[model samples]
Structures are given as C-alpha cells and as structure tokens.
Target: MLAYFGPRGTFTEQAARGFATPQQELVPFDTVPAALTATRRGETEAACVPVENSVEGAVPATMDALTEGEPLVAVAEAVLPVRFSVLRRPGGGPVRTVASHPHALAQVRHWLAEHLPDAEVVATTSTSAAARAVLNGDFDAAVSAPVAVRHYPLEVMATDVADVRDAKTRFLLFRRPGPLPEPTGHDRTSVVCTAADRVGALADLLAELALRGINLTRIESRPTKDRLGEYRFYIDLDGHAAEPRVGDALAGLHRHCQHIRFLGSYPKAEPGGVPAGNDAFVSAAGWVADIREGRGA
Candidate 1:
C-alpha cells in the first residue's frame, strides 16, 4: 500500500505511520491536493489526508480534495490527537511572533490568547515548515506537534500547549476502484451530496436519514464553487453502505439530491489501541515494503 501525507512531521504523517503496515510505502506532499493527484494518477495506490480537527473544526482543503478528486474510496479512518508544543529559541526572551500552519494556528487560538497575547501570528504552509522556521531562528516560536520539534531540531518550551483538552483530528485513507476488504465490525460511511439551493431540500435529505433512524456523526457544508448560493453537503455517519439502512438512505438521497458521491465506507480506528497523540516511529522499512508489494488491505 502506498500512503501520502502532508509532511514529515505533521499530525497527518504521524497518524499515517500508525495505520500503515510495517511494509506500507509512505509518500509526502506539501498540499493535500498534490497527494490526491499522486494517488489519482496511479503514482501511488492509496493516499492519507486529514479531514477534521476537534479544535479547528473542518479542514476545507481535505473537503475540497474529496469533492474534486476522481472516485477515491476511503478505506480506513483514524483520529490523531493534536497536541501543540511551543518551540522557542535556545535562550527564551520576549517572543513577539508565533508561526504555524494556518489551521494549526486556529486550533491553538485560545492558547495564543492566554500566552502570547501580543505576538504576531504568521501563517506558514505546514507545521513542519513552521518548526523549521523557528529552528532557523527566523520566528520567536512555533505552534506545532511534538514530532515537529524533533524533526526540525527545535526545543519544546511547552507540551500539550493547545488551549483545549482532548482535541482530535480525523484522517482518511483513500484508494480508487477496487473491492475493499470485508468490514471488521467497526466502520463509518462518508458521502457528499449537493442539495437544491432551494430551502427544505437539505431538510428533506436529513429527514430521509432520520426516517430510517440513521445517526449522523458529522455534517459539514462546502461552497460548490458555483454561484454564491450553491452548496454541497459532506456527511459522516455510523454504519457501512453494505448495511441495509445506510444503503437505503443513500439511494433515497440520490433520487432527490442534485449530485451524489459516496466517498467510502471503511473501518474506523481501533478501539483501545494507540491514542492519537503518542504515536511511536518505527523505521519505515516494513511500511515501505507493504505499499510497494500491494498488501495495503
């Protein structure tokens, strides 16, 4: 199995390490779109990308990639806990600027308010890049994951520094056009559908799900990139499409919705397994082997 992620030390990469088999081949990209492109072009078999964060809410880029990419089915889901660590110069002083990826900066807004209230926030493209900037002494501090401090050779002044407790980010593994392995008792189904710009079209879609007693775990709306009033709905709900109620709701949704896309119905995170924030890095030896050999399942 080939896997793709944001960068070497971002939370997305950290999450991918945990889900991949020892033989999985991992690839890195600066943007989620680039990663999706790599997978779509058959340069890689599967791509891993972040979907949402507990603190920062939805990741718009991931949503956009899913909506635009060709028929990539989600195979597995994982939630990695986000813990921002404060990285500073060797000799700490009155730090004036805080740097981080825009999304990570949003996740730690409360912490920034409480700690560096006067610091200017600069948006970097990725957390790993922010940590590198701080390491080069270009920024006073960086808000990034603990893994970044080690990757970029930076010092951590604060651990779990994010303002919120128990913040988690969900990641999805995407693969194209294949019969996925059978369900393993724990899974989720994700779908994207465009509701009529008209009022009540969205309500009618939800009512269909409600009528079937299907519980929604997440619901998010994205601009359809059309006129200002048009929108698309992305949904994550309990159960798999192979199940009856879920399959029925999707069928009903397709009849009424303008556009319908089923991203995937795949296994969820392993219960009582490794918690999201504390993933250990083994050599990529096994992971690299798995992706190249086609044992991704």
Candidate 2:
C-alpha cells in the first residue's frame, strides 16, 4: 500500500496514484508527516508527499520531517503540473470569502487579487479541506485542485486560475533507508548540510562542491532549531552519490560542515537525458574501486 497526504482528492493522492499498481491500495492521512510516519513504521510500503513547488519553493513541513525524524530515503519523484479551479457552491451568491491551502492560495494570488480583490482569504490544511470548508458554509468559494470539484458540492467558476500557467510541484516517494540506488546517469542527490556559524562557512560549503564540478540543482536554508542564527542547507545536485566526483564532493563537504544528511540519489525527472559524469567519471570510479579492493592503484 502507498500512504499519501490526503482526504482522498489531493494533489499528493494524484501523484501517489500515478506510481501505484492496479492491485496496490492507497491510504490517505490528514498530513504529510502522518503519511511519511506510516512509511517509517512499516504501516505502508511507501509515502507520497509534496516536497517542493515551482512558485512556492520547498514545503517547510515536509523538509522539517525529512531533516529530523528516523531518516527516510527518497526512492523516486513525480512532478505534477498544477491547475487549480475556483470552486463555489451552485447558486452561491458571490465570493465574499476565499479559502484554500496557503500554497494553493499563493499560486493564484494575482487571479484572486484581480477577480475578488476584497474577498477575505482563509487558509486550510489542504486544498480538499478548503473545498470541505466551502461545503460546510464556512466560506463561499475555494481555490482547489480540479479533482476537488467531484468530491465536494462545488462548481468550477474558473479553471486554470494560477498566475503562472507552468507552475509545477514535485512530489517524492519515500521509503526506509537502504543501499543507495544504482546510478542512472541522469540522477539527483539531495543532502542536508549544517555549517558552523562563521565567516565564509556557507561559501566554503559551495566551494567544495564547485571544485569537484558537482552542479547544484537546488539549495534552500532552514533553521537548525538548536538556536537562533544557526541554519542548515538543503541541497540537490546533478549526479548520483555513487559517482566518484560526486562522492568526493560529499567527502569534502563533510569535512567543512558539522552534519551532513544524505537524503537519497534518484533518477532525474527529465527523459532521454545524458547520464551525468560521462566516461571520465566512470573511469575514475573504477580506478578508486580497484585501489580500495587492492586490485591495482
């Protein structure tokens, strides 16, 4: 079974369904952490949760859970093109109040401003929850995923209401940590780096990756929570950790940072892309393996 953040009609559920086989069951939890916790406790085979969005960046709650808890490994990822609909009850007088998950609201900020400038906006736990709120008469309308209309007694006043047409959210499939995935040539590795509070600390961390030609795909900072002014970086890089150059860059980063958490290395989202590292990286990896095995230097 796959556990997903949901009330049944959430984007997280959509992503989870894409990966599930016909016979596999999908269980919905109210929150992202709850779904992931199920995976950690072996209640589910995997958890599907949103990690980042193109417009909103990283999802803080998801990031915090991955950084703190009993170490879950991301096995795969799904990028979903998001399109939200403005939903209201049939014959609803007007949109006096708008409700939605904060991320969903943000994505349609401009649309809401231009269409219902004076409408009071409220946040909900999930987009589906927002629809439920509207159904319960807590609000007149909701900004929700297209699927939400089916689950709730809501009408689509407008479709594709996002300010940006190309907005996308990335969802990750997480499982218990195990052997690192084999290199796919086109892969991404995520890690968390906690650097000491000092001058050039952040720079030194980047320099280590730069020197080894590891291309960082994404980087975001989060509070370490131990104290104020102490932060850790969540970084995503182009190559798999199994690659020699990528492994070397991680080693260098480990020396410069206080703590390093290897999230996982998974296949990149793009299709038909060239594998990272090429022949040069492969040769170097082979040489290092040979030396470690005492076969040759």
Candidate 3:
C-alpha cells in the first residue's frame, strides 16, 4: 500500500496516483511528517510527499523531516505540473473570500489580484481542505487542484490559475531502509551531509563529486538549528549510487564531510542522462585491484 500527504484532491494525491501501480492502495495522511512516519513505523509500505517546487524551491517541511526522526529512503519520484483552479458552489455568489494552502495561494497571487482584487485570501491546511471550507460555506471559493471538483460538490470558477505559466513540483515515495533499487543507468542518488568547517569546506565537498565525474543535479542547505553557523546540505546527484563513479564519489564525500545520511538511489522522474566516467572509474578500480594482488608493474 502507498500513503500520501493529503486529505485527498491534493497535488500529492495526483503525484502518488501516477507513482503507484494500480494494485497499490493509496492512503492519505494529514501532514508530511505523518505520512513519512507511517512508513517508518511500518504502518504502510511507502509514503509520498512533495520535495521541491519549481516556483518555491525546496519544501522545508519535507527536507527537515527526511533528515530527522527514523530514517526513510525515497524509492521513486514523480513531477507534476503546478496547475490550479478556483472552485465554488454551482450557484454561489461572487468570490468574496478565497481559500487555499499558502503555497497554492502564492502561485495564483497575480491571477487572483487581477480577477478578484477585493477577495480576501485565507490559508488552509490543504487545498482539499479549502474545498471542504467552501462546501461548509466558510469560504466562497477555493483554489485547488482540478481534481478537487470531482471530490467535492464544487464547480470550477476559474481554470488554469497560475502566476507562472509552467511551474512544477517534484514528489518522492519513501520507505524504511532496505535493499535499494538497482541502477537504471539514468537515475538519481540523494544525500544530506554537513561540511567540515574549514576554508572552502563546501567547495571541497562538491569537488569530491566533480573529481569523480558525478554530476550534481541540485544542492540546498538548511540550518542545523542546533547552532548559528551550522548547516546541513541536501544534494541530488545524477546516476544511481550503485554506479562505480557515484559510489566512489560518495566514499570521497564520506571521508570529507562532518556527517552524512544516504537518502536512497532511485530512477529519475524524467530520466535521460548518465554520469560521466563510470566506465573509466570501473577500469581504474580494476587496475588498482590488480596492483594490490601483485598482477601489475
């Protein structure tokens, strides 16, 4: 079974639907931590949660939650288009008050301002929750996924509501540590680590990967929260961890960093690129092994 951060009709639900096979039963949790915690507790096989947004960068709640508590590893991921619609009761009055999650509200800020300048914006826990508010007559309209209309007795009043034309969000399905997925050649390996405090610490940390020809896809740092200057970095690299180049790069990182946590290696949502130097790395390692066995000059 699969669990998702939702009350249903969330973008997470949409992403989970796509990530799960037809046989996987999808369940919903109230919060990101709750969904992930379920996976940690073995209440469910896996949980789906949003990790990043094109318009919003990293989702702090997800980044921090993944790094904290019992360890969970992302097994698969999906990227969904950031599309929203304004929904209201079929014969409802003008949209005097609009409700949605803060992230959803931010995406349609300009659109709402242009179309309903007088409408008051209210924050809800989830977009589906916003639809429930409209159903309860607490708000006149809700900014929600297009799918919300199917779940609630609401009709779309405004369609394709977005300030940015083509925004997207990335979601990951996670489960407790176990055997990792095999390398698909085109895959992603993610980790969170803290640099050893020194001159050019971050630079040196990145160089560990670069020297091994591992392509860094994304990198972001969050405060350790334990101290003022301490930070933990969240990184995504091209290629699966099982790949020789990636494995070696991580070994180099292990020796170079203050701390590290493996967040699993999984297939990319839109796979294509393979890291450079895998063949060279494998060959070089073979040569070194040969020398150690006294088979080389």
Candidate 4:
C-alpha cells in the first residue's frame, strides 16, 4: 500500500495514482508529513508529497520535514500541469466568498481580481477541502482541481484558470532508506547540505559539481533554524549516485560541507537528456586499486 497527501480530489492524489501499481492501495493523509510519517513507521510502503511548484517554489513543509526526524528518501517523482477550476453549488449566483488552498489561490489571483473582484477569498488546507467547504455551505465558490467537481456535487464556474499558462507541480514518492532504484541513465540525485558560514562556501559547493561535470538541475536553501544565518541547501543534480561522476561529486561535497544528506537517486518522470558518465573516475579508481595490490602500478 502507498500513502499520499490528500483529502481526495487533489493533484497529489492524481500524481499518486500514477505511481500506484495495480496491486497497490492508496491511503490518504491529512498532511504531507503525516503521510511520510506513516511510511517511516512502516504503515505504508511509501508516501507521496509535493516538493516543488514552478510558480511558488519549493514546499517548505516538505523540505523541512525530510531533513528532520529519521531520514526519508524520494524513490520516484511525478510532474503535473497546474490548471485550476472554480467550482460552486448548482444554480448560478453572485459569488460573495471564494475559498481554496493558498497556492491554488495564488495561481489565480489575477483572474479572480478581474472576474470576481467583489468576491472575498478565503484559504483552505487543500483544494478538495475547499470544495468540501463550499458543499457544506461554508463558502460560495472554490478554486479546486478539475477532478474535485466530480468528487463533490459542484459545477465549475471557471475553467483553465491560472496566472501562468504552463505552471507545474512536482511530487515525490518517499520511503525509508534501503536499496536505491537502479540508475536509469536519465535520473536525478537529490541531497541536502550545510555549508560553512563563510565567504565562498556556497560557491565551493557548486565548484565540486562543476569540476565533476555533473549537471546541477536545481538548488534551494532553507533556514537551519538553529542559527540566524545558517541554511540547508536542497540540491537536485542530473545523474544517479551510482554513476562515477555523481559519486565523485558527492564525495567532494562530503569533504567540503559541514554536513550532507543523500536523499535518493531516482529516474526522471519524463526521461530525455544526456546520459551521465564518468569513465575517467572509474579508470582512475581501477588504476589506484591495482597499485595498492601486489600488482604493479
């Protein structure tokens, strides 16, 4: 079974469905951390949670949650196009109040201001939760996933509502540390690291990747909360840890950073990129091993 951050009719659920095998059952949690905790506790095989959104940046709760408590590793990822639909109960009426998740509302802020300027907006825990609130007569309308209208008996007031036409959200499936997935040529490795509080520290970290020829796909820093200026960086690189280059880069990171955590290396959702390679590192290791042995260098 798999656990997902959901109340049903959420994009997380949609992404989770894509990850679930035919034999897998999905259990929904009220929050991302709860779902991950379920996996950590062995209640479920894994948990699905949103990690990043093209429009709003990384999900702080998820980024912070992964670094706290027992470590969890993301084994898979899915990206879903973000398009919202505003739903309300039957019978067209003036929308006096609108509700949805903060992220969802932010995506449609401009549209709401133009179409429903007089409508007061409220925030809910999830888009589906907002639809439920509207069903329960708590709000006049809800900005929700298109699937939410089917789950709840609501009509869409507006469709294809978004401030950005191509916004997307990336979700990840996490499980307790164990054997990692095999390298898929086109894969991503993620890690969190704390650099020394000094000049050139961050640049030094990037320099390791640059020297290794490892592509740095994405990087985000979150406050460490232990100190005023200390922060933990969440980095995504285009390669699997099993690859020679990525392994060398990770080794360099360990030597340079005060602390580092390997999240996991997983296949890309949509694979299409240069394959990661490091034949030089492998040959060099073989050469050093030969010399260390009774054999000649």
- TM-scores of all candidate predictions against the true structure: 0.76, 0.80, 0.90, 0.87
On lDDT, the leading prediction is 4
Candidate 3 residue lDDT tens string, 1-297: 888888798888888888788899989887788898889999999998889872223378888899889999988988878989899988988889999989899989999989989999999978888999999999999999877887898988888888888788899989899999977777999999987455787888899988877788999977787656666889999988788888888998888777889998999998476845678888898999999999995
Order the candidates by lDDT, highest first: 4, 3, 2, 1
> How many backbone clashes does every candidate have?
9, 2, 0, 0
Ranking by TM-score: 3, 4, 2, 1
Which sections of candidate 4 miss by over 4 Å? 54-58, 90-96, 113-120, 227-230, 293-297
Global lDDT for candidate 2? 0.83
The Cα RMSD in angstroms, rounded to one decimal, for candidate 1 relative to the true structure is 11.8
* Model 2, TM vs. native: 0.80
| Candidate 4 lDDT by residue in tens digits, 43-75 | 999998889872223378888888887889989
RMSD of 4: 2.7
How many backbone clashes are present in model 4? 0
Assess the local accuracy of residue 226 in candidate 4 as a C-alpha lDDT between 0 and 100.
77
Summing lDDT over every window of 10 consecutive residues in candidate 4, give the lowest-scoring window. 53-62
Q: Cα deviation in Å at residue 31, candidate 2?
A: 3.1
